[model samples]
Target: MSRDATSSLAAQIDARLSAPGAMDAARFASFLGGQQRLGLTHGGRALCRHLRPYLIAEHDYAAVARAAERIAAALERVARRALVDAALAEELGLSADERALAALDPGEGPFLTVGRLDMLVTEGGFSFIEYNADSPAGITDQLLIEETLMALPHLAPLRRGRGVRAPAPHRALLCALREGYAAWGGREARPTIAIVDWKTAATSAEFNVLADLFSAEGHRALILDPDELELDGGRLSAGGERIDLVYRRVITQELVGRRGLDHPLVRAYRDRAAYVANSFRTKPLNKKAAFAVLSAPEFADLFSPEQRAAIAEHIPWTRRVRSGRTSWRGRDVDLLELIGAEQESFVLKPNDDYGGKGVLLGWQTPPDAWRAAVRDAEAQRAIVQERSRARTARMPTFRDGGVAEEEVYFDLCPFVFAGRMEGAMVRLSASAVSNVSAGGGVTGLLIVDDPRLKREDNRHV
Candidate 1:
């Protein structure tokens, strides 16, 4: 589809969603209740229950697939090279533990398996803000919203006429785990699976959805907090049920190590007693500073031509917070000096965090506040990046029981499992910090197909 056509279709969807009696307070409340019924709650709060659906032109999804595939390839190249190429890993500024985790090798499938790249796509194209290559959230929350949207009466006509649809992210996750399990030598038709996470973590509620998905697929699924499981007598068991596959949702080694639970899982993982998808080795690539490595010219040779081009096109300028001189756009300059002089052109972020934690938007902050944020980022081992403005979508949603149409920033999260693109997690926020956990609401990712797309495809064929 042409750019104008895509824009027009998105407008039509937005208008329909905002149409009178399309979605009311009572209907929205029922949707929230449905989320609770599906276990889409984090910290006992209905996860993304208040947000409306995000529509995507199917052509845009295809473009996302092409870009995401390249990004995935680059990430895998970095993961693979970090293991054998010591010099490359050192340049990434990885901690000792991070280095080991990157080099430990999960043995099969993509090392950066089951990940998400948080990105912004506007008229020009999409550029990533951060990559959650380890333990990304919203896998089940998005699915729940999509299900509700598909069942709504107001959306019934649009769904049938426009070919509105969403892929099953949970189902893709299950398939990815089974592949990893078989690679680790699991022979059973239905392997017992455990969803591991902190007992009191906010995201624990999503575990029930995962458990149900596993069960529906003919496998035994158990939601076990890190402290509840143990490895003994040559078997890894949770609640006395033998665990054949571990879908790890917890990665904080210190917390799990304090109780000596990391020992069993790590040992079992190395000994192949059980399979752990996204095994402990994805820590380094999950860092915000990882993009710094990808964007640097020195590492260009490590990636293929296609990967390098995609990195340059879609990745913004990023560098770890430190006191030193560096090159920016081929010009040598003092890092802090450039940041201070061009404060509005940059954003600061903690290297390892989620839910928009420790993010400082330079464009939105005063000079004094921006300087203060820079000091904080330096103290916390964070990264200062070139700010990439996101395109806003008009979302017609309910606020205080009233119908309201507002321009909201949208972020597209494409999930990658075993190096393959699956369903996505799309979110909208009135603010630049478009994090679902931080009041940035989620929406059903609808692939709106049209005749123009099919015509273009036929010509290609």
Candidate 2:
């Protein structure tokens, strides 16, 4: 579709929202009450305060999913190669401890059972910024958010018989976990799953919600912190329950950093005692440098013609922050000199951080401060990527007993389970960085089939 067509669809939704009596103060308050009752929150605030969810066309979503799957498969291939290729490992900046754990045999499972790739959909097209293969969040609460929105009387007009459906990331998550368990040689009908993460983590509400979902599906589920885990009689147990599958939410770097290689989780995974989603082998591709590898010309031979085409089309120009020479726009240049000259066109990021931490947007930073950051990045693990413009739209934001349209930057984050594209999470922010932890808000992504548009397939969510 053309840019005008896309804007027309989004504008239509906004029109419905701005219609009289559609989204009044009382209705907004009731929506908040419903979200609170369901515990759909992030950082102690309601997950989304908008009256309408992010509307995406079914065809656009299918294209986005296709791009995501191709790029993710390419990354997984590189990740598996990085496990034994010393030069590739060095390029990815893997630490000694990380290398040791990544090399350990993770009995049977996809390298990344559950992952999320952050992408931006703009008029120019879709550009994937980063891959979160380690431990992707924002899965379960989407279902609750969708339910809350569908129940709101204000949104019924747009959703009625239009086939407006939210993608089921939680369902895909459960399927991946069960498949991983079966691949790990489990014979049980449903394995006991554990949602493990730090005890004081702010996203604890999401963990509880996921645990409840698992229990309702006839699987014994437990929420436990890493400290509460124990290995007894060559078996892994947590909270006095045997864990057959571990839906590990703990970051690999944090796990190895705090507990070292001898951590019971690591030992159990290495010994094939328990199945772990996103096995330790995910460390290499989890880094932001994975984008660097994909975009760099030296590694072009690692991908097929189709995969390479997807890489060039979807990935931005990215390179590790080092003082050496690298290619830019198909030409070799001094990396440091180019960064120093064109600071406004790039973004500096830590190779292994999340939630917008240690991220420096060059366009938003002072020249002197950006120079210092560049020097610091060169000395450590970091990547400088060309900035992709974030897509913006006028969304109905509620405030002070009224609803007003405000322009917000939003991103489309699709969840990938065992190499298949499932649902997605839409994050809206007033600033360039769009993240829930960075003062951004999330809304359910409703994939609606527009009878007016041409059909791509008969698939329904």
Which has the greatest lDDT?
2
Clashing pairs in 1: none
Instruction: Evaluate all candidate structures by whole-model CA lDDT and list the values in order.
Output: 0.74, 0.84
Specify the poorest-scoring 10-residue window by lDDT in model 2. Answer: 1-10
CA RMSD for every model? 3.0, 2.5
Model 2 lDDT per residue over 1-461, tens place: 23322455567666776677777777787888777777788756788877677777777778788888999999998898998898989889899998998888887667789889998877678789999999888997678886787566656665565466778999999988888888878877988888888998778888888998899999999988988888888799976789888889999999888988888899889888888877898988888999999998889999989899889888999999888888887678999989889998899999989999989999999999999998899777889999887768777877876678788898888999999999888888898889888888888777766667666652312
Model 1: ten consecutive residues of lowest lDDT: 452-461
The CA lDDT at 11 in model 1 is 66
lDDT of 1: 0.74
The runs of at least 3 residues in candidate 1 whose Cα sits more than 4 Å from the true structure, single-residue gaps closed, are 1-20, 49-52, 102-105, 159-162, 253-262, 376-379, 454-461
